[model samples]
Target chain A: MKAVAVLPGKPNSVHLREIPQPKLNDQPHAHVCSIPEGRAVLVKTLQIGVDATDREINEALYGNAPPGGEHLVIGHESFGEVLEVGAKVTELKPGDLVSCTVRRPGGSIYDKIGRNDITSEETYYERGINLCHGYMTEMFVDDAEYMVKVPPQLRHLGVLSEPASVCAKAIDQAYLAQHRLQVWSPKRAFVLGAGQIGLLATMMLKLRGLDVYTLATKPGPHRKSEIATAYGATYVSTKQESMHDLAKRVGKP
Target chain B: MKAVAVLPGKPNSVHLREIPQPKLNDQPHAHVCSIPEGRAVLVKTLQIGVDATDREINEALYGNAPPGGEHLVIGHESFGEVLEVGAKVTELKPGDLVSCTVRRPGGSIYDKIGRNDITSEETYYERGINLCHGYMTEMFVDDAEYMVKVPPQLRHLGVLSEPASVCAKAIDQAYLAQHRLQVWSPKRAFVLGAGQIGLLATMMLKLRGLDVYTLATKPGPHRKSEIATAYGATYVSTKQESMHDLAKRVGKP
Candidate 1:
């Protein structure tokens, strides 16, 4: 199997390398291979999205190889085709399209609750970013619990689920905060830094019926601002107005 | 007015000092005091809660003195009574019991959207914890928007709101992360450390109908464990089982 990997702590060392293909019913840690592990699926690679985290890992800003390994596989945002499944796997089967979550569970109780993303302890691991092989290979195996199913209508968009999940998490958090005050009905939102995350957040907020405003360094009538406006969001370029002035104009929430 | 303050970068220098009281119509930076700042409210201190952040500030672990000032007031969690309001203040009134939020808005758009708690930039200010004066003083003024009203029934419990808010934020974040799967109904929660935050989290989780378990270093048959049991939550002493074992027993969400 071919995989994209980076030499840990070595900047600009990203390359394609041959790795052993994963085997079904192979339990590296288990004493007996015959023991059935429920909900474990092996996925064949389809698409991998490159984002800022990948760039950082390539730059050796922050990434770690799996224990005893010198290189780390480098892709967390990915779409894949399910090629194999363990005996007890029921949610997914061969030919199913899916997207795998980036961060894997650590030893924390929050991790046990499938909420490792909010684990206060810093022991959590993200695929490709640190201490684990990611889905940037020809194929990978992960617990079916961590994979989200992609519908046939949205197969191409599955690779985008990882980044979109970030926005979803942010909006969910905002609503949770607002839940403190039961009367709060958010009418407006301001998203800074019109990057992928920002634009996705703008789209999410627009979908929620909020008048969205996005601030970015790119001077508009640029494509980014146009996309924001197309989503019924107002776009502002920092070059024209200072953040302080824009915040004042938007006023308090 | 007398307030407890600490000189930044100097450990164990906490002392009481008399600072000038805030004026109703004084605008320190504005060219005119009558510029009609409507949201700012003047609060009279009633109660202040001491937490680890205060200890950190006292030990010079992390805290900043206000700019142009020699020391920073050291209390972020507090309950107070509204003393005065600007022309536009509407949510609160004079003599109203309230709890003022510790963190103040920064230049980020997150701050503008009333979500400064999740502000991405590190420029945000914490009352008494950083560059802003905290609520340990006799009286302090803040924007009416930052104050959470305390009902008469919960007046005595109002001081607990700050610590409770931390737990609230954590649970909110956990739910946000869990929101990825639509059918996720958490059946159990394990709170580690059994401190103020942990206990409060246990209570919140119990309120949400989960079987809550608390892990603490203290031996069982103690007051903390009794409180846990009183809340209908199970208490586990770390002396009996390690965190790793406990997490495995709880299973995955």
Candidate 2:
């Protein structure tokens, strides 16, 4: 199989190379192979989203090649189709679309509790971002537990799952803090950036009935601002108004 | 009333001074007084927890005096008794024990959504920490919405609420991330420090049925270590075992 890879410690050395395909395995911990033990699913890659992390990896800013491997596969945000299922897998079948999560569990209690994202040990691996192969290749396999099933109606939007998860996590924390108030009702939201993360967050906040406002450095009438308006968010140009001034104008909710 | 305050830009220049007491108000946004419209509460200070934030403020590392004030009051973690309530305040009454939340809402959508903690705008205020009077005074008033009722049984533990709230926020985020998994269960927690924040986290994780381990540089049988053990958590001395080696021994949960 041909895969996109970056040579470790070699900045801007991304290249396409032929790599050996993964094998099927019975052990749950096997990284490159489908788990034959009924808990893993073999996935054929369909789409991969390239984001800042991939650019940073290519720049040698951060990212690690697998142990003893000179090059690392480079892509994490991914959507794929399940090609095979382990004997015990019951929730999914071949041809099901799925999106694989980036961060893998580490040897921490956080991982045990399904929180590899906040693993306290600082030793967790992110697919394509560090010490692990990602889903930029023709095919890959992951434990079924780590894959989010994509609804057929939204399969085309599956590549967005990873970034959307980030927005979900942020909103979840905000709500947790708001729980301190007895009659809490968030009415307005200000998103600081107009990038994918900010736009996605704006959409989520708008869906929750909050008046959403997004600030970006770009001029008005741009595509990003258009998208924000399309999502019912008011877009502001930071070049014209300082955050402090804008915040003061907004007043307290 | 006599209050402790720090002169900004002058490290360790904390001193006692007589300050004017707050008054009742009808506007909900007034900081130091009860809302006269029956939606606020007047609180008399009962206990205050002095922690690292106070030390930093004293050292002039961070913290701001309220607008037009030369010195900032120096306390945020507080337990108080409600002395009065506005007409609209139904959740709290006179003589009830309460611990006030530190951060106040800013004029942003996050504040509207009850998420002043993660306010996207930097204009948010933390009582006694920045641009607001802290709870070090003899008496204060706040909107009833910001106070957390401290049960009579836990009044003695009330001062710990602020620090415990930090741990609560962290665990809440961790659990939110873990929700990505279908059968998430965190079995162990490793807290890196034995300071107030870490100790509180250790206690919270232990309560959640996880085998908690806290690492500190201090030798065994110390007070902090004893507290961890009392909470059913194991204390490890980092002086003896390297973190990498310890993590390897613990392995992935």
Candidate 3:
């Protein structure tokens, strides 16, 4: 299997190399496999997306990472058919399209994004960012439970599921936490970036009825603003004002 | 108004001082307020709970603060009454009981909890932590939108809105986040710690239908375990099993 692994620090050191193919072990769970001891997944990478975290680990210091020297695979975002199952596997079968949970069990998805930005142990072990090879490989094995079925309605976006779900899950979790405090919901929000995650988060926020604002790092009179608007966001350019000011401007009744 | 300000870090050096009460002069729909801001209750705190962070900064190596000192009033978890309001205040009144949002604003409620542990200028602010004076004071003003009406149903637990909300919000957020992912709400889960946050999270989790397990730092039967189980948690001693192990245990079906 050919996978992209990052040789930390020395920039542009991402290597697309042939590693022995990952084989599936048996673990029963169409829903989620416990992180250790039960199963591994072998995914033939179909269209793994380049994540912002991959860029950060490959370039900047976003914190929440272990000192970088391990061979790091760049893409954690992936979707493909489950080619084999662990001997213990009883849930997922061959050809099932699945995605990884941006959250490894016991970790915050927010932190996962932070780690996905820089590398972290938990994020690493979950796949792509850590020792567990990302789906950039011809096949990747994961704890069966962490891999969930990508519904048929979302098959077109199945490969986008891991990343989209991260956004979805984070937003959902944020809402849950919020509701415990207040009886109402947040009807408006500010999304600081306009990249993939930002876009997805923006979309999810809109789905939840929030009047979304996408504040781009770099703004044009009508560039990212247009893209953001198309994606259900009202554009706010940081070039014109900080996120606070923008949220104030929009959040104001 | 009188408040206890954590001047610098020396706990003993805390300043018991008075500052002018907060007065809202902006338009009722000023950009300064978010909708949940209505939930933000201005409480005249009777008692403020001391948190672990205060203990660390005051007793540890943060160094003694300056003479006038950067005073931070130490109470985050608090209970209070609505004393005053701007023309915009409606959801709550001058005498209604209320609590505070663990986080500041701009993000969704779900975003707050998921990012609650992470301090961002936007997500957290107002009358707690650093940005504004905390509740360990005579009177403090907060965004009214973040407050929640105490359910008469849980009247047995005379705990304040802030503390209860923290746990309540966490548990609710966990479920909300889970449900958004695919519609499967968590029926079982684990709380990594049984401390203030953990205990609250446990209660909330249980209320959400999760069979929670508390991983206490020090095993042996203790008050926290009793509280945890009372709220429907299964106990696990951190002394006996690793959190990682416990996480794996919960990860299993």
Candidate 4:
């Protein structure tokens, strides 16, 4: 299968190459075949979202990498469909649609079932980082728990789920969980940056209900900020007026 | 009273000088003047928390503050008693023990009752950031809403509240709110580092029921691992183990 490999862990380190078709065998620790055990599926990739953190990490590390490996398969956000299943596989089967984060699900069923700290207790299921393989390829395998069945409405959003979920969580953290939405909260919020993460943050914040505002540091009238506004923000400028005063005034409503 | 002031923005820009004592004056904001406010009482300071963020920002900006200079009078995160209040202030009275987060009730009563996001907004009320004040001083003011009555069990944990709350928030972010305990099962968690944040992450994960593990880049014993285990974690030397094998074992857990 074809995949992108990081040659030296640098910004320009990516090399597209063919590798041995993933052995779809069902090893005890890995599923070479989709039909391995309890609940898992194999997927053929349709799309994957590239992430900034990925770029940044690669650039920071430059070419230096951990000892044994000189090249690595890159990417995790993926959308695909099952082609087969094992006897124990239940939630998925041939041709079911799916998308999931880089994280995988592992450990005893009991541990998964009982943990109170899912993030901490989560099996180290990163596909692209700190793990054996990832799904930038034509095919891959994933546990059912890592899979999110894309509803028909959201099917268009396929592999975008990883980021959308992240945005959702950030919104939950910054507003909903913090009780930011109350009787008379600010009708507007202005995200100062116009980068990808900032845009995503703005998107989620808007979803939680703020007249979202995005600040364009340089102007081409950033589309990201516009999208943020369309979602709900009221874009602001650092040079226009004091955001502090605006926050005080607009926040009153 | 003595206060550190920044005259300009620079690494070497700080001056510890004596400033006029800030006495209770007729300020439009809430005050604890030992007067009758319905349920709230104003308190004098008993303890204040030191914030590292404050120190850096101060050194960076020579105290050439933006508008709303009054907010800089004192830092947040302190325990104090209600000294005085308007006849309307209630819920706290003088001598009631309380430890407060830097959470500002907000910019105004209109904002508060209206649930305006302004006063409480991170952009508006972020303590120690923006032009907002830090939490190191002889005295400061707080509202009943921003105040959390310290539990008897946590009485001795006074100044630790700020850091503990931060740790609590991170763990909660990583696990609790995101269904860390409910979904995304894990067999083992390898906390990549053994710093304060990492240690706290370990502890929180343990509390949530993960076989917590730690990997430190530096030389050290598993003191953090021990605390994590006490809090609930398994231990491992990240450098000593093969990450792929570790992931395989834990990913399938």
Q: Give all TM-scores, in the order shown.
A: 0.53, 0.58, 0.46, 0.50
Using TM-score as the measure, name the better of candidate 1 and candidate 4: 1
Residue A8 miss distance in model 3 (angstroms)? 3.1
Candidate 4 chain A: worst-modelled 10 consecutive residues by lDDT = A27-36
lDDT by residue (A19-72, candidate 4, tens digit) is 766433533125321233556566778887677745754564522332356765
**Winner on TM-score (3 vs 4):** 4
TM-score of chain A of 3: 0.74
Candidate 3 backbone clash number? 50
Clashes of 4: 68
Task: Rank the candidate models, highest lDDT first.
Answer: 2, 1, 3, 4
Q: Which candidate number has the best TM-score?
A: 2
Compute the lDDT for candidate 3. 0.62
Interface RMSD over true interface Cα atoms for each candidate: 8.5, 7.8, 9.0, 7.2
lDDT of 4 by residue, B1-253 (tens): 6655454355654556565544434222332112123434345666766556556655564232436453343344566555665455566665566776554444465354734323444444444444444445555454456556666566666655666667776565454333422344455667876655677677766777777776665433556656655665655566666567677777644
lDDT of 1 by residue, A1-253 (tens): 8999999899999999999998765542231112246667888999999989899999999898877789999998989999989888888989999999877766566666767777645654778887777778998877777789999899868888999999998788767655543335678898998888999999999999998989998789988999999999999999999889988887765
lDDT of 2 at B199: 91
Q: Report the candidate with higher TM-score, 1 versus 2.
A: 2
**Model 1 residue A81 distance off true place after TM-score fit, in angstroms:** 1.3
Individual DockQ of the candidates?
Answer: 0.05, 0.08, 0.09, 0.08
What TM-score does prediction 3 earn? 0.46
| True C-alpha contacts between chains kept, each model in order | 0.00, 0.00, 0.14, 0.05
What does candidate 3's lDDT look like per residue over A1-253, in tens digits?
A: 6777766655666677776765465322222224355466655666788866777767633212223336655577887887777666677787888886544432444334433322322432445564444567776667775677877677788877777877876776667654434345456787878777888888888888778878786766565567678876787777778866765666543
What does the lDDT come to for candidate 1?
0.82
Q: What is the C-alpha RMSD of each candidate to the true structure, in Å?
A: 12.0, 8.3, 13.3, 10.6
